[model samples]
Target: MAIKPITGMLRRQAVLDISVALGLGTASGYAWWYGYHVPAVRHRDQFYQKIEEERAKAMGQQSS
Candidate 1:
């Protein structure tokens, strides 16, 4: 079987397609990491504040 050589236009098209795929992949990855992953991480102060508020509310109810 004879091997077919890639033409200049084909090579350029291939390079462009790969570049676009990489760029889109990077953007989507950043979006997922920053938007979904970062927000999913719990903040200590927010969690503690909620707990403290609930405790104070419970104490106030019991004292009344």
Candidate 2:
């Protein structure tokens, strides 16, 4: 026996899958950017400043 596929149902399912994939991809990208990337970028200068201060303090201690 051979099975036949329905055209409209297949098309509908394909469209739904594509739309879901696109939506999830966009949402994850947005989440990653805001959750990880943005915070790192925002704190970058502060991180550098703290490191510089620590290094200066170490240098002063070494020189003493």
Candidate 3:
């Protein structure tokens, strides 16, 4: 007996599923590395200070 080849919608769906899986894996891997592998000191203190100031300003605006 010979193996049959996939054709039409089934083949398309298989390709789509594989592409989506690879895309998701890449995105999640990047997220994991960004969140855990990188050191906090990678960013300068001034950057964090600016973010903190912006957050405080937003909070102040919300309360007003």
Candidate 4:
């Protein structure tokens, strides 16, 4: 089989396709991180913070 030579138009088209793929990949990655990861991490931190606050209050009441 003969190898196909890369033409200028083909090169440009390839570039556009690659750029679009990279952009979409970046956007989806950001959406997943912000929508899912960030909220989960925030919820976890808030949960721990609430637990700490309750513990502190309980300790204060014991000391009083």
Clashes of 3: 0
Q: List the residue pairs that clash in candidate 2.
A: none
Model 2, TM vs. native: 0.63
Local distance difference test values of all predictions, in order: 0.90, 0.96, 0.86, 0.98
What C-alpha lDDT does candidate 2 achieve relative to the native structure? 0.96
Off by over 4 Å in 1: 1-6, 43-64
Tens-digit lDDT track of model 3 for 1-64: 9999756988899999999999999999998788865645556666889999999999999999
**Clash counts for the predictions, in order:** 0, 0, 0, 0
For model 4, the stretches where C-alpha displacement exceeds 4 angstroms are 1-6
lDDT of 1: 0.90
lDDT of 2 by residue, 8-36 (tens): 99889999999999999999999999999
| Model 3 quality (TM-score) | 0.48
Error of 3 at 2 (Å): 27
What TM-score does prediction 1 earn? Answer: 0.56
**Cα lDDT tens digits for candidate 1, 1-64:** 9999767988899999999999999999999998887776656667888999999999999999
Model 2: lowest-lDDT 10 consecutive positions: 2-11
TM for every model, in the order presented, reads 0.56, 0.63, 0.48, 0.78
Model 3 alpha-carbon drift over 4 Å, by segment: 1-7, 40-64
Q: lDDT at 12 for candidate 2? A: 95
Runs in model 2 deviating more than 4 A are 1-5, 49-64
Clashing residue pairs in candidate 1 are none
What digit string (tens of lDDT, one per residue) describes model 4 on residues 1-64? 9999867998899999999999999999999999999999999999999999999999999999
